[model samples]
Each structure stands twice: as C-alpha cells, then as structure tokens.
Target: MKQRVVPIAVLAGALFAVNVVARLITRFGFDGDDTAQYRITIGMFATIGVILASVAYVRAQKSLPSEWLPSLAAAAIGGMLLTILVGPFLSGGYPFSAGAGNFFSQIWLYGGFAIVGILFGYWIATMLGRDYRSQSLKAFTAAKAGKPRRVVRR
Candidate 1:
C-alpha cells in the first residue's frame, strides 16, 4: 500500500507544484492580462500531458495498464483537487470565484488531458512492442515457434 501510495503522492505533488508555478506566474507576471493567463494554462496542461505520458511509458515496460492506470488517474485527480481548492487560496483568491462553470471546466480539462496522455504513452509503447502484454505475447510466440515437433508413430 505504501509503495503504491507513495509514488502516486509524489506524482500528484509534482503536478501540483507545476500548477502552483503556473498560477504564480499568471498572478504576479501577467496581473490583469487574460492572454498570458490563457497561454500559461495551456502550457500547464501540455506539461501535465507530457508528464503523464512519460509515466505511462515507464510503467508499461513492467506492468499491465490495468495495474498502473488507476494510480495515474488517482494522481491526476489528487493533484487537480489540490490545485483547484488549495491553490486559489495561496494565490490570494477564492477557489470558485470564477463560478461553477469554470470550476467544472478545470476538472474536465484535467481529466481529458490525463486520459489522452496515458493513451498516447501506452499507444507508443504498444507500437514499439515494448509494453508488458506485447512483450509477453512476443515471447510466447517465439517459444512456440522454436519448439521441436514430435513425430507420430505409425
């Protein structure tokens, strides 16, 4: 349990850190500029996608998607919750001051990006024939092909 939780927490923390940095930049650097805020948000999402994709690639090499995907989702959700709830306070603003629509939009965006990232990573691993299941199937096929056939006695 610790092993699973620790890594997920670390992933979540790293993601939260990215969010904090983006939020800080938007708050301090951009001030009233919506354009810079939008750009920063987009970049933040892209960074999250890349991070998740990298994690998926690494996990695919050793474990089935079923084993690691839930962890990835949990990490994303945890980080997003922290970013949306706690982050605003840190930035001297209310969490839902932007209204419910914007709040929900954030959730949707984060979830969508996470799913896409994981899929992208897993797809690349499969294409490379390096994923756990792919490697297993390849080994099975190779072993079967290498086996000698027994002759039937008349």
Candidate 2:
C-alpha cells in the first residue's frame, strides 16, 4: 500500500506539472485573451486523453482501473489546484473574476474532462478484447507446449 501510494503520488505530480506548464504557456506565450486560454485548456485535455488511451492500450485490463484511477484522480485534484492557484499569478487574472463563475467550476470542468478521457480509454481497450485474447493465447501455448498432461486421480 505504501509503495503503491508513493508511485501514484509521483505520477500525479508529473501530471500536475504538465497542467502547470500548459497553463503557464497559455498565460505567457499567447495573448492574454479568454479564447486563447480556453483553446489551450482544450488542447491540454486532448493531450491527456491521447495519453490515457495509449496507456490503456498497453496496460492489462485486470490492473487498468486500480493502477491508473488513483493517479488520475490525484492528477485531477492537483491539476485543478494548479490552475486555480497559478492562473491569476501567471495570467494576471483572477480565477473567478466577475465574468467567470465560482472557483469550484474549475474543479468540475477539469474533473469531468479527465474522467471522460479515462473512461473512453478504458472502454476502447475493453471493446478491442486484447486482454482476453492475450490470456487465451498464453493458456493455449502453455497447455500445448508443456509436459504431457497427467491423468486426474479422483
């Protein structure tokens, strides 16, 4: 449990760093316009989706949710925090300005998008049945190539 938590925390931190970098880039690299900021946010989410899908394709189904969900949830939380805390500092704008809604809205927006991405990845992997095929092939090979089968003693 301790070992697992450590790695998850580290991965979540990495995800948070990605979000921070994206936010910083959008804040400084482009015009301080709402549309540009929104576009950058969208691109960041899309990148996350692609990454999750790739991970799902490579990861085994049995361990998919367990291994990824904690880190993902942590990342979502950390990402939201990064956006809220650093948004104003880097963008020279308040997180919830007069035009924007409450701060919690940011949390919902980021969480919803992250969850959707993760679910989409998991669904695609499951629909492809790669895990099942891999296990089946392994069983078949083991049974066929291993030593002769011994008769069962009732």
| Candidate 1: clashing residue pairs, number | 0
TM-score of candidate 2 on Cα atoms, chains taken together: 0.67
Candidate 1 residues 6-122, lDDT tens each? 999999999999999999998899989999898898899889989999999999989998999999999989998998898888678888988989888888888888889989999
Which pairs clash in model 1? Answer: none
Model 2: weakest 10-residue lDDT segment is 55-64
Q: How do the residues 31-114 of candidate 2 rate in per-residue lDDT, one tens digit apiece?
A: 658788788877876776565555555554655467666665665566557666665565666766634564676666666776
| Winning candidate number (lDDT) | 1
Runs with alpha carbons beyond 4 Å of true place in candidate 1: none
